[model samples]
Target chain A: MGLVNSIFATVQFEILRVLTLRRLSVAVIMALFPPTMIFWLQAGGALASPGFIITLFCGMVCLLSLLLWSTSNVYAELEGKSWAFITSRPYGRWSILFGKFLVAFLVSFIISWIALSLCMLVTGDLDFNILNDGKEVPKMQVWLALSGLLFLASMVYAAIFSLLGVLIQRRAMAIAVVFFTVVEVVFAVIPAVVGKFAMSFHMFCLLTHWVGWVPPSAGQDEDANEILQDFLNVYGRQDAWVHLAVIFAMTLLSLSLAAYVICKREYITLEDSQV
Target chain B: MIEFHNVTKLYKTVIGVNDISLKIEPGVYGLLGPNGSGKTTFINLVMGQLRPSMGHLSVFGMDPWQNDGLLNRIGLCPAIQAHYPFISGLKWVAYLTQLRGFSRKQSHQMAAESLAVVGMEYAMNRAMSSYSLGMRQRTVLAQSIAHKPELLILDEPFNGLDPKGRYEMTVFLKSWVKEGRSVILASHILHEVESLNPSLLLVSGGRLLASGSPQQVRSIIANCPNSVRVRCRQTAELAALVTGNFEIKSISINSEAEELEIESMNPLELLKLLPGLAMKNNLLISELRSSDDSLQNIFSMLMLIHRGGMRLPE
Candidate 1:
């Protein structure tokens, strides 16, 4: 119980510091970019497809939320050498790791939801006439599904980056490159079977189904219909659920292992750590 | 109380700590060793940060490695060349107190008091990033004593303190010991530890060379001559008489000042015979000082003796 309290205290302290330093402000501002741009384009009647705007908003929220939360809570802490203060205390190492996980999770979750809410409000106010193709999906249900997928994406990315923060010294650059070049782009181009391994792909597929992008006739356009069918099939598959579950499990496992390593390792001197 | 039984910590190709066995009682214990002599490693082992490769270590009747409960009663002020830039001095101390299980209100109160004790109350609100090296050191000291644990371990506590600050800290540490608590102070500065009058643990090359009272440790230094200075009005007369009567190693007279420096083979006998000699010579003795009993001389002698006697394996 004491350990838990200490961990929470540390998390609160760090969040307060990060917020005060204006470090997260830039990221929070960046989260609004996709929605703002989508709204502006819609106002100008320049938006090609309304469905694409929603997809862009969802992707942007997931990507930006993951990047911001991971950097602030995990990468920044390591670079700041703040762990030394926590590790020197009597609290268990697992408590510290879990505390950080909770903070990053909550921050990303809240920011992503806020961005999605704004996007929904803007689309509703504008009466953009999205989903007018005679496919009846409730607006609230669609928003919920999109939000859920964003939440999952944020969790997986935050966890992976948290582990990277612990294992690698230069974690920020590593996460940035991996997030942009590999997880975001490469996974989208891969086949459904292979793409499910990537967090971004699972989220993209899940959002597509919730938005009712599945076509009626299999012969209308083979490639488009096949992509839509793959989305529906993979979303319902037990294997996809298991993949998300595994990623979540690995996050906990990896974090715990890192905590154990830090607890036992001797910090020979403060001299070795530049931060 | 702390006990180490033939403990050894090895890091791959390098040795962190060699076979070290000692029992520390309730008082100040000075861990005197040069840099890379494993002082920090020894402290980390006691704190359970590092596992010993061989043997056992127990603090307060529990193995620190597996015993989180024992840590509640221990306080540590690590060397302060490293610190978090974003934290304020007060916040740093308060956070550590919170980790020790104090409530937020209680921790804040303790933090304020600890900072005051270390004479850092004025700088409490300032960010550590803006603090000078000496102020940062004081903040570290404040954090260590915030909880007032049964045992306190300080690594080079006086590293960057000015003389006045050092004096204040030494006095506070002395009083802390009087409350039946123990403190283990590690430092390369022998004089700083000497002021605390602590039981000594001397290490070199990752090995414990001697462990006992400062006086006893000084005696372990072999082949080091002890010198005594006697200041009297008739210094020339006393020097001439003493040289003939006793087997004086050497004598030097200060012509400008009335004083005689006598190098003796045995400092203990010289100290014992000083009053008698003063009375016989009818000399008004203003002062009598022994150079060998000083910490600087004792530390140098210990280092020299160890270097001459011990042989490291190639």
Candidate 2:
């Protein structure tokens, strides 16, 4: 009960403080950048298909959520020495870690939902007739299934990044920059099937097929029979569930390990020489 | 009450605390140590922020580690002055109280009362960033006392206070003891602890040196003879006459002033013989003051003895 109160106190304070800061406003704006660009490109006929646009937007949302929760919020808290005050409370260290994870995940989830909503509104891709009209529109059931999968994936991604934020000091910014600039771009260019290891890849795969916002790839029509076989092999088989389970398990393991490390490790003394 | 049975805390290759055993009962107690002498580490151990690597520690009859109920009865004011930058002092105090399970209204009331106790009510509504160092220290103290804890541990509570502020804190702490509450005040400023009149616990190099009443610890030093400075017109004759005749250990002439310092083991005898000695020498005595009995000198002597004892090559 005390741990719950402490967690609520920590999260409430963090959310309020983060919202009040102008830098968070800037981060929110940055999160919208990719979706906005995709919208403009789709309107200008820059994309080969609408399916690509939806995939890119969903991928960006996932990436933005990962970056915002892991880098901006985590770095700000560490620099402010707010964790010292939070950890000093009677709550166990696990409660603190879980509280931070909850805040980061919720914030990222909300931001992604907002971005997704905006993309849907701008693209006018929510029409149910598109699927019945033989436009290869994903069934509503598939969309719901994909949304659940993405939500779980986003939670796992946020947890992993938050743990990374705690373990590595002063690396949040550099990691975020490198992730967005080099790693994300490189992963995006790789074939979608090969991109499953990247969180963005799985998110994009689920989003593109579920929403009619983007059309199927050029080669997908030629290989429709092969694609169906592949989709069944990938999603119908137990491998996909295993992948989700592994990611969830990794998230839980990282969070628990991070909590253990934080609970045991001492804060560097003020008298020590700075790096 | 707090008890440490041979508690030791090591930080990697460094020794934060070593084989420290002591029992503290209800009353104000001062933890006197220099910087990096593990005062904060010791406080952390008591607060369960750090676990002991050896021996055992318990507060309020429960192991501080994994004991939330026991921690509920204790409060800590850390040495660092950093606070959540976004909240007012009142809100910070109220927030902490709420986390401790008080209702919002009760927490607010407690915050106001604690702030009043620290004499920081006027600045309670202001953002913590706007507070001065002394004001921040007072706010920290207010938060520590917000829950009316039985055991209030303050690490360097007097660090940034001015003389008046220090005096106010001293009076507040004395009142706390009057309520039968215990406080563990850690500070390097011996004079500040002296003003608190707490049972002294001296520590050096992660080792407990002495733990007892201030006077008891002061007596542990080798006998420091009381010295008297006397300004007399016939200083040369009086100095020569007083030397080697009346248990006077030594006499020294003040280089910058017309004064003589008479060192003696017995200050009462020296005082009684001063008039006769001055009359015999035909000297007019103007001023007299004794030097070795002050708390500062006693503390220095005690520290010297402690260091000397530690240096016996054990």
Best by DockQ: 2
lDDT of each: 0.70, 0.68
Model number with the top lDDT: 1
Tell me the interface RMSD of every candidate, in Å: 4.2, 3.9
Error of 1 at A100 (Å): 1.9
lDDT for residue A263 in candidate 1, whole number 0-100: 61
The count of residue-pair clashes in candidate 2 stands at 4
Query: Candidate 1: lDDT of A256?
Result: 67
- Candidate 2 stretches with Cα past 4 Å from truth are A39-45, A49-79, A82-84, A92-95, A124-134, A138-150, A165-275, B101-106, B218-304, B307-314
TM-score of chain B of each: 0.74, 0.77
lDDT of 1 by residue, B1-314 (tens): 78999998887657777888888877889998877778878887888877788999998888987456777688888774546567788887887778777777888999999999888989898888898888888888888888888899998898888888788888889888888899999987777888778998987667787788878765554235567888878878878777876656899988568888898765565667766876877877788888566445655555555667532111
Shift of residue A106 alpha carbon in model 2, Å? 1.7
Reference A-B contact fraction recovered by candidate 2: 0.18
- Model 1's i-RMS, to one decimal, reads 4.2
